[model samples]
Target chain A: MVEPVLDVKGLEKSFGALKATNGASLDLRPGEIHALIGPNGAGKSTLINQISGALAPDAGSIRFLGTDITMLDTARRARMGLARTFQISSLAQEFSALRNVMLAVQARQGTSLRFFRPVASDVSLTEPAMRMLSRVGLADRANVPAAALSHGERRQLEIAVALAMEPKAFLLDEPMAGMGPEGSKALTGFLDGLRREAPILLVEHDMDAVFALADRVSVLVYGRIIATGSVSEIRNDPEVRRAYLGEPA
Target chain B: MGARETTVNVLLVLLLPAVALTALFIGEAFYITLATRIAILALAAVGLNIALGLGGLVSFGHAAFFGLGGYVAGVLATHAFNMEPVAFGLPGTTAMPAIWLVAILLCGLVALPIGLVSLRTSGVYFIMITLAFAQMIYYFAISWPAYGGEDGLSLSMRNGFPGLNTAKPFPYFVVVFVLLLAGLLLFHRLRASRFGAALEAARQNPARLAAIGISPFAIRLVAFVLSAMITGLAGALFADLNRFVSPSMLSWHMSGELIVLIILGGKNRLFGPLAGAALYVLFEYALGGLTERWQLFLGLVLLAVVFFARGGLIGLLAGRPRHG
Candidate 1:
């Protein structure tokens, strides 16, 4: 069997009496869209946070490319090619869209430590950053500050930033949130093609986009993986139906 | 970038040196001394602006570094005067370059730990912790009897600068003015660099900074240490200007005034500290000459500026906050 690019095993976390994640195990193979689906407050985001190193699991082992990364910092994990985006918009609001993406490009190129040269005029940094921006269809709005961008545009900018990371895998949490249907359709198409670049562990609620894009689906209920299968099988599973899909068992 | 901002900057860069030179030509040593104060204070505020304006780290412990710089100058000047061999068997020298090197190194050494500890907490907690650490240093200065202690130490003469008679106010002002200009140019370069972009981004959203594969803690820490070194250098100049080193340099009021200098001119503007320092010194000279109770008038003026002018004097003039 091919080794998964991102592997998590027996992960667990608790806040007082509540278990945010309970022995959750999953693996993301290269170039596959593995969608994680759950009802609201089912700890999908919590699990993503733990996987992304934003929140540490109380007990678990996460191996990326076969190296254990459970104790690594979020930035270190990102540097190692594990990229992520927040569910809520987390961006440098005051920065223009081009500059925001340029930061990611600078980080990736290891040029952020160079203090003398102007990043604005550096063709090396701006060229790739602009390419990433264009990928998200934000080519024209590159100079607008992130705070001033419409909600859909901010979401697009986040994708541009992530793309600039040159990631080994992507952990996108609710990338479709706050996006109108047209924007959703556009991004859904983009993410579909993006999965070919790197495997994606997609945590999302929009079932239409999820079902359309996922190679396989895992139904998470109360932090446990209740079922994992191809999209249609998981969609028709009785456990997912009663516990999550709000259908009679 | 606006026409008004460019004109204001031209005036700011020109007026002080012009006035200082004119005063020197008129043979008024007192006015030259005042200009030196502005240059030194502006230099100190420029250092604080790196952390405060760009990185958005409001370091209240900056006075600690400033005072440390002053003390470095004082202790070395004292040891050199007494012909005492100091630690590491290196005899103290009254050389400006030597004193500046020692001051910057010592400030960096102290700032590393202070920044490491304080940067772990942010907002008001960070502010209080930095202030508390500075106060600790202040108390230590008062109690350390080997130096002048509570009364402070006085230099026998100004530290020597090679190829210049620094005892003369005009030449001394030239030294300070040149250093301050160099610092401003460096600040401009740093603000436009890649490091600066990440630092500013960290201030806006640390999580996003991390997501982009840069550690916010590391960025802010570097900025803090650099800020300390700059302020420490200014402190060295300030001690030389007055030919005195005291605990007051380490006081919270000193820290507050440094921040006020940044704010009064405009927070984060490259010329904000210079503008604020010029205005502050002007207020001190003008209002101080008029009445004994000038601080009250200064307070009222400051209140009007803070309440009505959110971006500060530069913001009032420049049509926008340049650095924010």
Candidate 2:
């Protein structure tokens, strides 16, 4: 088995009386495609948030690449090769699509305090961003403002930005949440290409895409993991079917 | 962003100096003085833009640092002219460069505390806290009897510039005009820097900025202080130009006017403050001459601009920004 790049044990979170996440645990091995699927309000986003250091879990220890990163801030976590995409697209809309990726590259490469020269002229930052954009099929739309991009294109741009970080693991929160059939197929192909390099923790509602791509599937219901196994095992499990699949086995 | 936008930017920067030179030549000493005031005030606005425009920190108490800069210049000149010692028995100097440095340092120091506290909160709370701090300083200035209290201090002669007669309106205007240009250039450079990008990112998407390894609070606080220092330098020039320093400079109204200048010109543009200041002074001169309640007209115009002109004069002139 591939050594785990991400390990979460006894992760718990609550909002007042509501337990949003309860003793949830997950393991994402290197170069593995892990799909976390559930209906609405399944705490999948919350789990990603904790691993990405956006939220502090109530009771849990998160280890990334053998380092205890539970106390790190989101940016620090990102710098440590952990990248994530927001459920709702959060990009610098006014800036060009290329500029967004360039900024991510700038964050990783050198001191961002370089003020004397124009950033666009800097080959170091722009080149890597361009390469990333091309990888995500957005090289042609590089100069267009992110606000002008289509929803699907914006999702592609978000992935491009994540790629600029050169991360070891990605917490992609519904990359195909609002995508159409064509968009979904494109994103799935993109994910398949990326799966040979870094591990992807995909939180998705699209079971078809999940079953198609996920090497290991984890079923979450009411903030608890009901089952975790291979696609066939999850599809055949009586408990998973009764609690989630809602189909007679 | 393109050759056309670049050409427009060049024309605007070049146009201000042309108008400033015309004002020096064709105008009376009074109008020349008015132009000087506009230029200096625009420089202050440019300073505020470093934070407000680029960093997205709307600091309401910038007047405190501005007034403090003016006081530093005024107080130092008063002591030097008299050949006496200041509060700590430190003899003052009449050198313009030294005064600017002192003003910048003092304002930066003062801004550190204000920024540290204000940065703890955000949105409405940040605005209110900064305003409250400025009021605190304004009240302090009004109550303090040492420098003339509310009466204000007047310089018998303008502070000396190294090789020129600063007492003459045109020469004095030239001095301030050059400083304003230099300040604008510095701002252009700062806005294009990596730190500037991070600061802007912090404003636009703080969560993402943090995810990228930059702390929003620290970035904003540093920007706030640097911004305050620049505005403070402009304020010192303002006092020297008028040969006067008063509590009015520190008033909350003055702070509001500075922000008004930024909005009027267009936030984040290179020459937005200059254009805004020129318009404001022109409006004040033209409207005040025509009506007794000129401020009422100005208020109405401002309202119209805020409602309709989303990007201000620069927006009207240059169009939407193409670059981040």
Candidate 3:
């Protein structure tokens, strides 16, 4: 079998007395979308935060492309090609959408110490940024400030920013939250093709999109991965239905 | 900037030199000195604007840098006057270039540790820590007897420039005005650079900036150091302009005045400091002529700026800035 692009082993975290993630293990293979689905209060965001280096895990080893990244800071991880998007659409609100993507592109290009040239006229930064915006179907909204963009457009801008990182793996936390049906469908299609560029570890709630697009699925409940399998297998698992699918045992 | 702002900025830039040169043609040396004071103070506030305005790092300790620059000039001038080495047998010079260079370098060096400690906390904590650092420097200056202690240091003569007689008010004013233009130009260039993009991003959303792979702390520290260097240069000039250096340059009131200058003109506008300094000096002149309690009126004006003019003078004249 192919080596996993991202591997988490025996992850654990706790807040005071409550354990948010307990002995959870998962991996994302190259060219595949691994959907992590769970109910509310199931520690999904906590686990994602640990993986993204926003929170320190109590116990875990996360290996990205055969390198241990458990001790790295968020910015270092991002510079090393671990791109992520916030669950609640975090962006430079005062910046234009194109400028937002341009920042990511500039980060990917290396040090931001260049002090004389105007970023507005730098084609090297702008061309690639414009391309990423176009790829996310936000070309027309490039000049609009991130604060002025609609909810769905901001989400699209987030994805465009992540794309600018040229990341090896994407830790996307709830990319579908607050998106309307039409927007969700369009994004589901976009994400379908994005797996070829970099494998995505997707944390999401939209069941239809998850079922239609996920190559494999993992069911998490109460800080544990109770089941992991192909979509059809996960859908039919008796314990998964009882614990997360809300079906009576 | 829009065309309207650009035009306003041009006029603002021109107004200072116009008034100063008009004073010169009419043989009014007092107004030329007043214009020099406005330019030097504006240069100092321009430095603070980099940290406070663009980077949103409200530093209440910039007077430490301003005073450091002043002391550099005072000490060097004293050593040169007495024909003695400053330290480690290093001889001092009365050259303006050398004084400014030492002042800028010393301020940047001092700001590094201060920024490292202060940048760790933000909001009121950041403000308090920076203020505490400035106060420490102020007290140190007061207790250091070699520099005349609380009595302050005095220059027997104004420092020398390469091509011109700096003792004359108009020639000195020209040099200061040129330096002010340089400071404004640097601010403009930095605001348009990649580092500036990251700096503003750090100000607006540090987490978002970090997620994109830039450390906000690092950006802020750099801005802080740069701000100090510029402010320190102004301090050196200020010492030459007054031909004296005192602990009062490092006082908390000086820090507050720098902040007030930025707020009165506009927080982030290019000509904000210049406008604010001009307005402040004019108020001091016009109001002092009318009454001994000029500060009361200045306080009321500041209040109106804070409440009614949200972005300060430039904001009212130019409208809101188009981009962050």
What would the per-residue lDDT of candidate 1 be over residues B1-324, giving only the tens digit for each residue? Answer: 567888988899898788888898898889989989998999999999999999999999899999999999999999999999778888988999999999999999999999999999999999999999999999999999999999999999999999999999988899999999989988888889999999999989999999878999999999999999999999999999999999999999999999989989888788899999999999999999999898788788789889998678888998774332
How high is the lDDT of residue A40 in model 3? 98
Q: Which ten residues in a row are the worst by lDDT in model 3 chain B?
A: B315-324
Clashing pairs in 2: A75-B210, A75-B211
For residues A1-249, write the lDDT of model 3, one tens digit per residue.
999988999999999999999999999999999999999999999999888888999998999898999999889889988899999999999999999999999999985888778899999999999999999999999999999999999999999999999999998899999999999999999999999999999999999999998999998899999999999999999999999989998
Off by more than 4 A, model 2: A1-3, B1-27, B84-89
Error of 2 at B125 (Å): 1.5
Tens-digit lDDT string for candidate 1 (A1-249): 999999999999999999989989999999899999999988998899888888999998999998999999999999999999889989999888999999998888876777788878888988999999998999999988899899999999999999999999999999999899999999999999999899999998999999999998998889899998999899789989999999998
Runs off by more than 4 Å, candidate 3:
none
In model 1, pairs of residues that clash are none
Local distance difference test scores for all models? 0.92, 0.86, 0.94
Per-prediction TM-score = 0.98, 0.94, 0.98
**lDDT score at residue B187, model 1, on the 0-100 scale:** 89
Better of 1 and 3 by lDDT: 3
Model 3, residue A137: distance off in Å is: 0.8
- Which candidate number would show the highest DockQ if scored against the true structure? 3
